[model samples]
Each structure stands twice: as structure tokens, then as C-alpha cells.
Target: MSLRSYLVNLKQALSSRTFKTPYRIVTGNQSADMDSVVSAITFAYLTYSLKTPNEYIIPLIDIPREDFALRRDINKLLSYHNITEDLLYFVEDFDKFLDKSTSIDLSLVDHNGLQGVEINKGFDGGQVNVEAIIDHHADEGHFENANPRIIRTCGSNSTLVFHYFHDLAAGQEEFWESNKDVIELSLGPLLIDTSNMTQKVEDPDIKAFEFYKKVLASDTVNFTAQSNYNDFYKTLKTAKKDISGFSFADILRKDYKQFKFLHDDRVGFSSISKPLSWIANKFSIQDIKDDLSRTLKANQIELLVITASFTQKDTGIYTREFCYYYEGQNEKYAELYQLVWQQLELSTDLYRSEAISSLTNGVNDSGSHLKIYNQKKVTATRKQVVPIVKEVLEK
Candidate 1:
């Protein structure tokens, strides 16, 4: 269903005796995650305009970068209108403040319950009472019993929000003007999130053309300053900066004493140096991809493995996109591309762990160099290692 219809149904349900009490809205903790925040704000706008006493609370779960593109969005909205820090709350710990009084609802604009499940799991399996969910992730038919689950696998979550606000604005110039701030705020996160996700549609080439068209048509002035890009990048950098501190070769010599081929079939494995692993946790997939590309070109290595570490919080998400050159034919890479679908079958934890293990554990074959991408496992000795979770490439 469209966000519009979902909002209508949600309004009806809210009017019902079921959700008449005051409630708080919980959203993703990460910055540049304007989708949830915008949705929550829109709902708050509705309550405020209607003179409802319902208090709207939007909580953030993570630390956004210094130049988070999305914050500029909220700043734009706040600039045009009157919004204060009071309207939005950031929290590193959810358990400290969450209860029925803290009505935690989600505005995930998609078709899947992956995020919903992930977020809810953080709350220890307690039913979050997610009254409604508005998202565009591929519809996996998950999220049971949500009041109004509007999951459409469209271009972006902002697209869904745009249609909702557009319909609600309905030719009101003043309202439209004010709403533009929300749209601007919503757009930054949407664009960045989609970009990071590597989201592609069936007709991806065509869709990309259309998507860029829409982006170009959008008011560039509404976007955050290019300077704002640094904050997100800084946060990303902070997440995975230490991986380069030590050479994997040196660590093997010191710790393992002797490197033995577990299999050496086609892929070779190298234990990430403790210092390097400590550092690698600060880099993301993109950083790894860029570095790998350079190293591969320099050493003329057809395939290489890079092991980085992230915190328990960001265990499953992939931070980089890699390009592999198959030996046989160009079509071989195409066939390898299809492995992503099979890869997606693995649960988030399994996927992240196995991928990291494959890289850090041991190599079986050297001829086929699988280019395993693994995250270093952090334990008591690695506690000093900071948590550097880069934004996963959403695609």
C-alpha cells in the first residue's frame, strides 16, 4: 500500500480506542537515516496540527558523522520552520529508556522485516508494539500484526513519504512551503541510504536514468552543504580506520610462528594482524574496495582477501562493494554476480561471520582466490579495539 493509504488507516486506528494513549516514536540510531526521522516528524506534525495531546518522541540510536548529510536536511526544515533539539532525541542505549510509555513504532519504508527484526531484537524480543511500518524494502511478507504495514519496493522510502505529504498538502501553498523542509530532510537520507545500499530495480539501467532525473530536478539548495558530506564520511572513516596499522604477513610470523596451508586449493587465507584488525574495524567496505583495487593492481593479484573488524552492533552489514576479475571470461563475473542472491539467503549474523571467517580463518585453494571478505572477531583482548561500523552498501 502507498504511504498515503497507510497513513489514513493509521489515523483511523489511532482514533480507535486501541492506540488512544500518548506514545513515543523510536527510530534507527544511525545518522543519515532520515527516512524514519522524517516519518516520525510527519506524524508529529499531524498531531500538532490537529491539536492532539499526543507527545511525539523520536529517538536516535547511533552517533551520526560530523557532517551528516541528513542533519542539514533537518536543519533546512528547522530553518524554514521552528524545530528544536527537543523534537529529536539521540540515544546510545535503548534499554535505559524504553517502555509502553515509550511507544516504539517504526517507519521503515520497505517490503521486508529485516530491519524491524534487527531493531526489535535489540530490545530483547519484546513486542515493540510497532503500530505501523512504512518502507520500500522488498516485501518479504514478514512483520506480523503491525497495525498498518505499508511495504512497497519502490525507488526509495522518501518517494513513499513524498507521495503521502504531497497528498496531504493538496494545493496548500503555505503548507507546501513548510513541507518542503521535511522533504529536503527526507531526501538526503533517502539518497545516501539508497546509494549506500546499491539498490537496483528490475530495469536498473532505466531506473537509474529516471532516478538521476528526479535527483537533478530536485532543489539542490534544499540539500545539505557539500561540507556536510564530511560528517558522514568522517563517521564512516572513524568506523574503519585502523585496519592498515599492521601487515598480515608480520602477524603470521609473530603469532602463528609458521604459516601452513590448511588447503590452499584456490583461495589463500591470512590471519589479520592484531594491530591491523584493530585498525581495519575502522574502515568500511568502500574503503576496503578502494584499497583492494589499488593493492590488486599494484601486486597484480587477481584475487585478494581483506579482513576488517567491526563491533558486535554492526556485525552483519557489509560496508564495501568489491569488483572481481574472473580469469575465464567476462561472463564468469556475471555468473559470480548471481552468487549474491544465494549469499543473501544467509542470515545477517551467519553471513557476516562466515564471510569474515573465510577471510581470517584459513585458505583452501590458491588457484581460485575467492577474495573472501571477512570481519575480524573481537574478544576480550580486542575490547580496546574501538567499534567502527561503516554503513553497509545497501545494494
Candidate 2:
């Protein structure tokens, strides 16, 4: 069973009478990325091979199938594996194809992101049962009964999936012949996430990397192996960082997460792989703000925080920026802007860029009421910022 053909069958079966009960929807995070998507796919494939009678473990791409093309890096990997876009199923597929209502069993991967009837428009309001969890993020202690709930601080979730099924995969020649394309494609994220097994590299990730290398070295395997590891990592890294073709709106939703604050105020944060100065310079500050405001309104979000992170192309030094916008009248919004900035300033986790720490220097103070600051604490992430935002909204 070629992985491509296997996926084709799964997608077709969703529409047929065989669309049975207890759909084990193995899925990644909604804010999907390479590591998360591949981890879900890899786990689903592993489970499919080892499942009991009538157990269907379907790998559900967390993003819509329509928006799949936006992920250029994923597209590149698919092209590399000769897998077509139509072969895979998305969150929207369950609604489009299933004839009878059925309960869904979710197998979480990468992140503990639950996609139930409330959040998933394509669920048809089915009962959601979380069955399993395999991830790399810090555990939030939800889903206590989830079997095989393996959570650890690894460099990438893909590594965990590969290791979980490593023995079965290595021993079976038939498995390699059929599933090599997907299993091989899984390496892209693992390599890119760990910086070619050089930076932020962990023992499990390194072990998996070494294991795959030896597997490829086998004479029986008919897979196409990359000649240069550096080249392979560079290709995936470049694909992820290449935002040249994307508009400002596309960039926002590419790696975005939204939350509900006080009074049901919807807030969003987008993590871009490019620096703020580069984006603002190329797209223009006003144009970026205009596009962001329109997007925020369309999504019913009151405010959006854009966190730009990247290494300088010239200097080769990594940095981050905290850019924020609150949608509405400039006159009324300006009052809230000062207060929120006051909260951010008070927090030790964040600080103004060295250039303008003394004043409200980077603020536009115009219609958009936008502010961009070079984040002093580069290591501080959204995990550190979200609680502060919730506190700010309370006051």
C-alpha cells in the first residue's frame, strides 16, 4: 500500500457506507506547522499498521485542505515525495463525506489542541472522545485518561513518533516499501526543527536521526535518500522562511493563535519567521497596519499581536519584535493603548528596544495606533506574554 494510495483510499472511504463508528481522528495542532502535521501523519500511519479489527485511525490535517497550499514547506515535502494534494483529508472532510453521525475519538499530537464541535465547523456536532496524546510541549494536565499520553520536552514531536514506532518500522521490509514516502518526508521537520541535529538537539531526536540514516543505508530499501544532510536541512529551512510570495494577510494566519480575553474580547497573535523591521520596510508600516486591521475585523478579533522572529540576513544575529494593533477609532483607542503599554512595560518578561525604552518611541499614535518594539528578552515567548495580556484586560 503506497502511502499516497492509502491516503486516497482513506479520503474516498470517508464518503462511503464504511464510514463507521468511533472515528479515531489523529490530528495535530490547529496552528499547524511541519513538525505538528508530520507527527500526526506518522502516528496515524503507525497506528493503522498495528490496529485491531475495525479500528480506523485517520490522520486529519488540522488545517483546511483548501489552505494547504499556503504552507510552502509542506508543499515542497509533498512534491519531494510525489504525493498529491488531493490524497489527504482535512478537518472539513468529515462533514463533507460522512453520511451518518458518529462519535469521534481524537488522538492528539504535537500540541494538546482539542478540536471538538464548538471549534471545528466540519464536525457536525459529534461527541468527541480524546483517546491518545503524543506531544513535545509541556503538559497542561488535561485528558487524564488519555492512553499512551507521552509528553516530554523534545526538540520536535516528529522524533517522538518515529521513536515510538522505530522497532516495528526497522524490522518490517514491507512497511518501508509502502510507507517510505511519508516516513521519509517526516525527516524534513525533524531536521529543520533541530537545526540539522546541531542546535536545540535532543538525545531522542539525535537517535531517530541516526536510526533513519542507517535505515536508508540498507540495501533493500528503495527510497531516494538525500546526498547531503546540510542541503536537505537548508532546503526545508529556506522553504519555511521564504515569505516572498505571501501578502501581509497570508502571513498573519500562517502561524497564528487566537484567544478570548475579558468581555469576550478576541485577541490573536501571529508568529512570523521574519523580523519586524524587514516586514515593515518592505510592506510599509501603514499598509501593514491597514491590512492587519481589516483582517482583525473580519475575524471578529479586537486586537492582534504580531511577534516577528528571525536572524538578521546581514548580521546573522537572531532577534524578535513585539508588534501590536487594536482595531477601532484612533481617538478612543489611544486611551487604552497607553494603559496596555503600561502593563507591558511593568512586566519584567518584556521591554522596549534599546533604542526607545525611555519614551513611547516606536508608537505610531495615528489611526492604526500601532507599536513595534524590539523585544529585549529574546527568549520570552507567548507562553510568557499571554498571562500578562489576560492581566492587562482585567485592569
Candidate 3:
């Protein structure tokens, strides 16, 4: 079946009374990046095509429907493939299923944790049985009992899902003919996540790419011939960094993660694609602090960290910045700040350049609610920084 037909069928199934128990919700991470969203959609489509008794496969993007606009890359890809919002379900839609008297099974993609409830408080009073997981991140062992738990340190979860379809399409020419769009759409995420197969490309990702190329070679749909990985990657990366319509809060929450830290305090780490100087120029330091405070209070968080990365428009050099914020009266927050400060100061490899701890030069002291750092010579990702913060919090 074509993607349009599959979407029509899916919409019908969602509204139909015949869509009985054993509903399978294929979901991705709370951040719902391009890779996560595509993996969930493709895997759920593949599962739906593979016949199962009374099982309705639904791809659930792990964010609100409105928030999808914050991810321009995702919107661009979906538009390119003619995917409409009506054909998709978001985290908020799960509540209706929870209220029903039906058994729900969850199939996680892109991430291997209980992200929907933990991050967004989406699934409430719902008894969900985890049936499977297909991911590429380091395992958190959240669903060890889930069957067919496929996890690897690959570039993208879409590549992992590609292997599933590739293996099934072997000697089955009809499978490729029926699901050509799925095969083509899946390639976008693989290329984007792997940086056009240049960065973080693992063995599995390469194998999947080769297998997909072979399938595309044999494909009569003529879709693969129209696009190349490099061009696609450029378009996607441009869109990924485009934060035109989003507010500061929307930009912060677009790719945010919350963690349980020392003494059960909630800590949030928000990753922004733009540089700190750009943000500072757009909004005043006081306004930024007020926004951070609002986010913390709304989420009931104790500490909030914002990490920004950008390229210098003049020299084309990449740089990073880290901003820390908390209510000044919190003792634990102060201790955590000091711990992070001390660690960054000692580590020459991570902080080879000077660390700037002031929002105002010589005007505000270390006890200020907001602290900004250059993080010079250190281009550590959240994957690297989160563990460091966790270690200090633990100590």
C-alpha cells in the first residue's frame, strides 16, 4: 500500500469500533526529533502491514500535536512526504485510550525508557504493556522484559528499522512495491542523524544503508532516483536549525530533558541550536533569567541548564555555551552549582578556554541567579555533560 492509503486506513482504524483490543502504540522519545518521529511512524506501519489478530498499530509521536511546529525539520520532511497532521497521533491523544476498557501495548522506538509519562505526564491511569523496543541509544534497562528488545549504539533508530524491512523484503518483491514510501521516507532520518553518513556511522547503519540502496535499485517507484543523501542532509540540517516562529520558551522546550537529581530535585537541561550571543542579543539577561524561572516553576524543577551551539558566521567556527540558573535561596542548588564550577575549572580538556561566570561584568557576583559560561575549547554534548552533573549531584 502507498503511504496515503496506509494513513487513510490508520485514520479509519482509529475511529472505527472494529479496532479492538491489543492496541499497539509505537512511540518515540519525548524530544521527538526527526529520527524518533520517523522511526515510530515507519515501524508502526511495518507492524501494521504484518498481520496480527486484533492488533492495531498506531504511531504515537511523544509530544503534543501543536509542538510539532517547533521542529521545522520534522515539518519539512512530513510535508515532503505528504504526511498530514490528521494521520498522526500525539502524546495527548493517549488519554482517550487510557479511559477506554482496552488493553494497550507499547512498542518504543528511538529511545529505551519510559519517556512519555516521565517527561510530559501524558499517559495517566493507563496500564500499558511494553511489547518491544527498537533503539540506538545506550540502554537504560528500563524495558528489559520487553520482547525483541533491539538496541545498538548506531547513528539512528531509523537505520535499525530499515534493517527489519530490508530483511523482510528479501525474496518478497511485493513488500517493496507495496511500501515504497516507507522505504524512501526512512532514508531521510538515517542520513540526517548520521550527518550524511559521515559522523557516528556504525556498522549496523552502514549495513542498513547498503541494504536500502539495493532495495531502491530494484524499486520501480522511481522515488529514490530523485534524491541523494548529501542534498537531503543539507536541507534537513538547515531546517533543524531554523527557529523562526518559535518563542524563547518554545526553543528551549523543543529539545529539553528533565532528570531526577540529588535529594529528588528535578533538573532540566535544554539544548538550543543557536549560540548564546544570539540569544543574548534577542533577549535581555534579565528576561532570560525570568524565562528560566518561569520554566522551573511550571515544571517544578530546582535547577535549569541551557546549552547552546552555533557556528561563527564570519569564520565558520563552531562554539558552545552553558548557562546555569536557579533560585538563589536553595542550598542544594548552590552546592550543585559550586560542584559543577569546581569540576569545569579543574578539567583542562573540557574547559581549555576561560570560563565566564558572569551575566554582567563586575556588576553581579557568583551568587547571582543566572550564570553564563563560554565553555571555550569544550564542545561536549548533553550526553557528556549530563553524567558529569549527575556525578556531582550524587557526591
**Which of the numbered candidates is closest to the native, going by highest lDDT?**
3
Off by over 4 Å in 1: 1-22, 29-59, 62-87, 91-93, 99-127, 144-147, 169-173, 190-395
Candidate 3, superposed: residue stretches over 4 Å from native: 51-54, 101-103, 118-126, 168-170, 218-227, 337-368, 376-379
Candidate 3: RMSD over Cα atoms?
Answer: 3.6
Model 2: lDDT of residue 321: 68
Error of 2 at 95 (Å): 3.8
**What are the per-residue Cα lDDT tens digits for candidate 1 across 95-167?**
3334433535443433234232235454456535555556654444556676456666554555554555445
Ranking by TM-score: 3, 2, 1
**Model 2 lDDT tens row, 1-395:** 55565567677776687776766678887667888778877787677765443345687776667668778888887777566777676757755433354567778898764642333444335566778898887676778898878888788889888777765456675665445565577778888777888766889988877766755654422334546667877887888877777888888878766766656667777888876555655675456756777878856777787777777676777776676777447443344445545444423232223433322233345454566666656665664565566566656
lDDT rank, highest first? 3, 2, 1
Model 1 TM-score relative to the real fold: 0.42
Worst lDDT window (10 residues) for model 2?
A: 351-360
Candidate 3 residue 189 Cα shift, in angstroms, is: 1.4
- Model 2: residues with Cα > 4 Å off, grouped in runs: 97-99, 115-126, 167-178, 219-226, 261-265, 284-286, 329-367, 381-395
Predicted structure 3, TM vs. truth? 0.86
Q: Each prediction's TM-score against the native?
A: 0.42, 0.82, 0.86
Q: What is the lDDT of candidate 3?
A: 0.72
lDDT of each: 0.38, 0.68, 0.72
Top candidate on TM-score is 3
Which candidate, 1 or 2, has the higher lDDT?
2
